[model samples]
Target: MEIRPMRSWIHHRRGEVLRQGGVGRSAMPGVYEDMLTRHGFEGRDAYLYRRHESTAWKRAEGAGIHLDLDGRLLEPTDLTDAGGNPLRLFYNPDGAVSVSRRSANMTYSARNADGDELYFVHKGTGTFYTEFGPIPYEPGDYVLLPKGVTYRIRPTGPDNYFMIIETTEELGFADIGPHGRRAPFDPGLLYVPSPELDDLGDGRNQDGEWPVRVKYQGGFTTAYYDFDPIDAIGWSGDLFPFKLNIRDFRPITSDRIHIMPSGHAVFATSTVVVGNYLPRPLESAPDAEPFPPIHRNMDYDEFLFTHAGTALGVPMPPASFALTPRGLHHGLPAKVEEELRKGIKPGTVADFEFIFVDWAHSLVATPEALAQKRAGDQLREGVAAQ
Candidate 1:
């Protein structure tokens, strides 16, 4: 809750501050002075830390992942129980990926890594057992596992599916200027069973061990260590798993023309922004454009994944994914706009269930994810076959 003053300056031909207004000549110097005067040494340190954190959050919030259309040879590992289907992994350049399947239960052990991981349950129900406690997750629930936090997953049903986004940097909430206080995807919105006690069942009756498996990369080879993955007993720290339901995300829109892209950000990390296109009324303008504008954004690489609706005029059958890299302009197809102009409510609650992952760093899609996109086409073909 520390507030910094604004410093305005007028620059001369030599790039020197000719005139200073408001507070000071530079924003940084004003901020530093404010920190030292208001907060003592300890407070100053906390202020600096918070400042850095805010910057990091902004960077991550503006970044995104663009879907890879080119098919490649990415790896898929099986971590499910006997006869259980395997969870597919789609790796991105920043060490982020998504896991999805019809009926698969997978477990990942806590380990030190160069990145942070996020789990979004698109469909299905399951429990995430962590050092803090067991958290029940379902479709639209987003969970984040900070780096080095130990945890595992236990499926409660047959069709347990998830979308995992792993990042090499810590993920956080986006900073919604001035009046914005709470995190875009506040942890409170994420439902953790009532009573906050382990009364669901025997905490030890789970099929797999408390600690499950660990995967790490070495020189020219990948190593897997198999042992009890849960060893975090009687330990406490700020790092832990937190879940937020996408449905609980409060969106900000406009009654006029257009809402800034930042308005669409639901959650963010160090280098990414998770945006939601919730169902809401568009700006009422008699001559308003029928579709959202295709504006060029430099801050993020946009990856739009269809969770339950058609996107950009494309009927994104379930599991369909698309990407638009930084500086790329994308919008609904022209024909879609024509349909909307004809007074058709083309947008629906189910049509806006897509998940957008924006990354600040350059991202390369894994072969497996590309294959999934290709498989989607095959699915369409199969539908045609019938």
Candidate 2:
């Protein structure tokens, strides 16, 4: 019988900061005990949770669950040289996700119309020949190729391994702010391939046999060329391939507080964000917590690929990959905390080099990545007891 503007129904008792008109916005009648803020609340995006506190260690139920990257993750990539094809790990229908391992040199050039590609060189050296030019890539180099760019990998040695991430969207560097831009080397230092247009002339493919496979519409169509595919007398455009070394990425740290994971982000798009945790000094404050805060991030599924160094004393070797789904609580173990308490030299580099990918949606874990997943019962039981 009453016509009034509908107000949020938040349950709150006196003395609660979340009470009606108290602190945060109130749409319901109860207090939201858990609040996650981005940009230290300056971003103005606050996620409120009811009866779900990420710090509730008692609810962090896990039993030593682990995804072993070296054994299980790499097992699915056992691509035989039957036809000299690369092994694919996973592919999504939306073309938003694709991971593959390439060892043998590629024979044909490829052009993807769906998205860009990022290749992490794990072993060997090679020259990535693209329409723009030739990029000499070595181990630890992250080479990025934009969509519609015809390119092929030419390995110089017999041993070569590559981790490739193909995304449906264009990839660009994160805002990173003035601080991150200043800490790392100048952005201009990134290596861009100079135009090396090599025309094979009319004799290279008189039979019109060389095919440049174009990927689109869920499949591929071959485009035959009378000459070599890398025939670009000269090219000019903002879109081109580039390479950056992991050693060139300098991490940003806080002297008095622990920096958030996003602080290390190097590149990102609407659906995915990529970060690099390079060797850096740990939190220098005597009482500061060196590890990330315990919380359940419901926004993105996190994937950590260990490229070098042990991650937070976890003994993560190179090529190790791990995925922590959304709503899961992951943090440093007690033993690690104890070790941190023992006192680390102020400038001691924690040697935690890894690539962190935060996907907006749940990442589809391949069966091979799930093969050797360790039980999380211990973590569950420990959290319950707490």
Candidate 3:
């Protein structure tokens, strides 16, 4: 299947709203208070109000909001009414749902879909159910669902948060040459619940039908389907739900020198590549120093979401993201490299996991994203000057 750069449809609309001076009425009763008094929203401020609103809005529109499926610019109408909901966003036209987990106590249903889905769990811990069984997932876990699978999420220990990328396209691993189907990364690593776990109280199947609710126009729309979302039955095929634990991705390395950035690839789609900082031995050869210059590869576009630890000597205060588009000369800044040369361990199992969703098709940054880029540069300068 052809891979395309995915964009967040919500961010584009939110940028429009911000450009248009916010949505709804700022003075109108806040969605929090209104939902609490009217819709029985009793969650904490963080859940009902704080961060949740923006998270929900972004998810509804799309995370990594790009243009559109046809590569056209996304407009406001492209976004569904994700307002008032605590944890989900529904897409227009296709009815695909993007669920964002903002709190640890959040529990929601994973209903059946007419199309396939890709879920990236960014934070928190939880138990996810498929028609087969329940699989426990933690932060940085990615899950893929085939079309028509029914599932639900239960945040067992703590409130967890994650982002789901729903699409009609079937997502699979990039084809490896000669190896054919059995690639280095086993498809089974994606984790389906065992039969023992499958017996965990009959999952979310309600009499062969699953209850799904959608938001359309300005109200709630509920629909019941006649088949269980997970009715894949006994079909063994390449296209199926899989999960890859980001932590389990073993990075290839060189014993005497740092490998090239492409060596850091954990996964790649047709147009996108996910890279990690895997552990490598320090290159201390004659005339070779411990620090390696940031090598720029122009073959693909790269966006790094800093999942953990400091990377390239840049002090990432956790959960912060950095983007290095194709042709952008990004590497360890000079001073940080100096520190590494002074006997710092050259590698650690890349504590940092970032998604590099490149597109075989070229992409253009939205005007709003461009403005954010300018602001980011200004902030970087301010920090340096400080």
User: lDDT winner among the candidates?
Assistant: 2
- Can you write out model 2's per-residue Cα lDDT over 164-221, one digit (the tens) per residue? 7777878887765568455655677689887676543321222546667777764787
Q: Which sections of candidate 2 miss by over 4 Å? A: 1-68, 71-100, 197-208, 312-314, 371-386
**Which one wins on TM-score?**
2
- TM-score of predicted structure 1: 0.64
lDDT of 3 at 383: 14
Instruction: Please state the error at residue 340 of candidate 3 in Å.
Output: 2.7
Candidate 3 per-residue lDDT, tens place, 8-32, comes to 2332222112122112212333332
Per-residue lDDT tens digits for candidate 1, residues 131-243, read 56667888888788777655556667766556677766567765545445553445455543222334333223145333333334511221233444443435455556678
State the displacement of the C-alpha of residue 322, model 2, in Å, after optimal TM-score superposition.
0.8
Q: List the candidate 1 regions with Cα displacement exceeding 4 Å.
A: 1-76, 79-93, 102-112, 179-187, 190-212, 217-237, 310-315, 327-329, 344-351, 374-386
TM-score against native, each model? 0.64, 0.76, 0.55
Cα distance off (Å), candidate 3, residue 293: 4.4
Task: State the local distance difference test value for candidate 2.
Answer: 0.60
Decide which is better by TM-score, 2 or 3: 2
